[model samples]
Target: MKKRNKFFTKKNGFICAFLAPGILLFLVIYAYPLVNIFATSFCRWNYKNFQAPEFLGWGHLFDNYIKMFTLDANFKMALINTVKWVVLTMVIQIPFTLLVALVLAKKPRGWKFTRNMFIIPNIISTAAIGLIFLNIYNPSRGIITEICNKINPGSNVSVLADGNYAFWGVTFAFILFGGSSCLLLLTQIFSIDPGIYEAAKVDGASAWQIDRKIILPLMRPMIGTVSIMAANYGLLLYNEIALITGGGPDNATFSLSYYIYRTALGSTKLNFARGNTAGVIQFILGILLVGCINKAFRTDQGD
Candidate 1:
């Protein structure tokens, strides 16, 4: 028994010591908040009861969850919009970013400049980007209005005034800012051994063939990684939406994060329980999203 204890202590003691700080931090920062949020989600809490949370009992524990889906219109819309954002990001933003990365990998003239320019938007604050888009979409003094007026003298189309246009306006505000995603993919492409490309060329493999068969296959894992990041970004979208639309045109552009914020702090009636419930749902949805993406892009060793 002493030998076994000594062996484990010698083998794992240093490793555990090294990991202790991080584990403690995780418990204090992440795990505790997550567990507390879930627990508080089942209680009745609001501004009135902010100091003390009342448990809903086992029988009515799911009332908050039920109310979110069936009672709250904003929550329903936020859920739909959040799902749409995730789907659009995975389908459009990721593919577009990959295409740019592939092109940049070819080292075309001015490619470095182009890549830097693409990343500039990401480096700048999302608030700034949102404000820039807001100006561009401005009906009175914006270029979009100018273009519309030029096309048909005296035409007025307010992008943020209508629900559909507001949604698309918000979408366009951040959809193309996949600079970080492109950079990640480009790094993956560059990490591949140059010898592989040389060998493929010797075999008369065209650029298209090399990319389709070799580069792309090898890049699946990185693509999966970037997809997960982008999907999460989309799911938790809030800053840009908050700055640009403010869930405007009658809450047409509400995201899950914004909805939570509105419920908890943004409104007169602060519902901490409902807000935390939304957060719990967001957390669970994020996990499911990551799982689905991993499953979809999972690499098979047999290949």
Candidate 2:
């Protein structure tokens, strides 16, 4: 017992030394900002009073939150768009990546080449990808316009100019490029023991049965991990809208992140308090999303 206690004490000192930097970094970087935003959400800190945040009285503590839901049309629209994007990530991106991972796991002819090609988009910088899609939706010199003209004879189909099309244009720009997530899923799938597959084959298990019963079940934790990442990306999407639509065609493409920027920093009439309030809501939503995905996947039960 004395030796064991001494061993643990020595190990604990090294563990504390290893953890100190990360804990300090988190406090300075993430925790401080989160606390600051949550506190300032109940204050009035805008261009008019930029020196310091003036706290709203106790009775009016929720004034900023109430104003967001009641009086702010832009915030409502941004929230709705953000939620839609999250749903799309779950419905489209997760499934599409899983499908690609499953297909590639079979090691088909040229599977390595195919996997490399699929991952190219994800490896490219997001800003560059945004610019590429922006030009693709251009009216005069874009492939889409040329294709439309070819099909319909003199039709000029400008995608990003219209609100509805702009939304979809932004969606398609980032939605299908789930290469990184697919790679993670593939790694998880490949890590399964080969002996299990051989035994299943001997037991008359078809490839489909193996994939459905064994692969899918084992990949749940990884799916949840990638889902959280994809969902967070969708929720905090800003660069695509900034480069493509700029929330244009009558403020139709406004997302929460974009809304926060415009409200707090981008616009002439900066409302820092309101933006912080939105940030608080976004923070809460992210926590809830992660919790829900963790529950759905039962990631805690993993081997």
- Superposed Cα deviation of residue 214, candidate 1 (Å): 2.5
1-303 per-residue lDDT for model 1 (tens digits):
987878687559899989999999999999999998899999999999889999999999899999999999999999999999999998899999998999999999999999999999889988898999899999987787788788988768788898999999999998988998899999999999989888989989998888888999889988998899899999999998898889988999999999999999899999999999999999999989888888888943234
TM-score of predicted structure 2: 0.89
Candidate models: Cα lDDT each? 0.92, 0.91
Locate the minimum summed-lDDT window of 10 residues in model 1: 294-303
Q: How big is the positional error of residue 88 in model 1, measured in Å on the Cα after superposition?
A: 0.7
Give the TM-scores of the predictions, in the order they appear. 0.90, 0.89
lDDT of 1: 0.92
Model 2 regions more than 4 Å off: 1-24, 203-205, 301-303
lDDT of 2 by residue, 1-303 (tens): 897778778679999999999999999999999999999999999999999999999999999999999999999989998999999999999999999999999999998898889899988888999899889999987788899999998878889888888888889999999988998899998898888788898999999998988889888999999999999999899999998888876788899999999999899999999999999999899989989988998776336
